[model samples]
Target: KDPKACTILLRGASKEILAEVERNLQDAMQVCRNVLLDPYLLPGGGAVEMEVSHRLTERSRAMTGVEQWPYRAVAQALEVVPRTLIQNCGASAIRVLTSLRAKHTQEGNSSWGVNGET
Candidate 1:
């Protein structure tokens, strides 16, 4: 195909991918809202934050199908939540990324670590 045609194809594909991501994010947000509103879900403030962070990570992973991007998305989302929530949770948004990175490194799947061979 022509170069212009290839570019257009790639753009279209990327748009589709992003649209799917948005849909998944919406579904995840709804689930998170439900869990947060449920009195039985998380009894304590710390538990609530931890659960939210964990859910965000899990949802991001489940939606993205890739390790890195999903983790990034989770971190970004967490950053947008209220600071009080993060403070009370005893975990920051970056902590989620760090944990994921550490897990990947331990599993020999990370490329940014010291060895740089995995």
Candidate 2:
């Protein structure tokens, strides 16, 4: 049995162009090596913010004192992640966020999010 791969030939206008492409490919490979070696990945794409906001909101509701206000404020601020994502996608932030919130509540899935393309 043979492990196999195909060669990719990059044609460029000049030696410098090829050199630059090679340098970028090497840089990307180095990053892959680092990831493989360390294997530490941070949560991204607004998931962490959304989860934090949800948890804080729940915790705030359970509180019966002034401390709840601060937690509520932080939760509301955490919402900016999804709101900004929708806004940047050229969608109506209020409408999308309202829909997203409804979906999350109804489906009971914290991962529910707006489709930026739609």
Candidate 3:
């Protein structure tokens, strides 16, 4: 047998659109390639960041005074990941992030992230 070749056609109204779409497709393909090379999957939509933030916040509780502040600060800082994601999508960052934070307070919901699709 020979080999199989696959083709992908990108259609857009303008060259700029075509180029942008091509770049996006290339990025997606790169992610696929990377996952194939390294067989591990990470959640998208800032899930990991939210989880880290939740863990940091929880760990901060054990600290006394100054040490606790840093952990809380970093935890708040980590929220910026999903907050920025929401802002970029033209959504309400405060509202969505607050809701996500509330959800993360519950056990087993540490991975909750802002849904940009909403």
Among the numbered candidates, top TM-score falls to: 3
Q: Rank the candidates by lDDT, best first.
A: 3, 2, 1
TM per candidate comes to 0.23, 0.55, 0.60
lDDT of 2 by residue, 1-118 (tens): 7758767677679999999998888899899989999998654345556777778888999998898999999989988998888888898988877766665554346666656686
TM-score of 2: 0.55
TM for candidate 1 is 0.23
- Backbone clash pairs for candidate 3 read none
Q: Pick out the ten consecutive residues of candidate 3 with the lowest summed lDDT.
A: 107-116
Model 1 Cα lDDT, one tens digit per residue, 3-106: 64322122235878977877777799799878789845323223333345555665566664465576656655653443444445565546644554444434
Against the true structure, candidate 3 reaches a TM-score of 0.60
Query: Tens-digit lDDT track for model 3 on 1-118?
Result: 7768778989999999999999999999999989899988546588888888988999999889888999999899988889899998899888888788788788877667767687
| Residue-level error in angstroms, candidate 2, position 100 | 1.9
Task: Find the number of clashing residue pairs for candidate 2.
Answer: 0
- Which is the better candidate, 1 or 2, if ranked by lDDT? 2
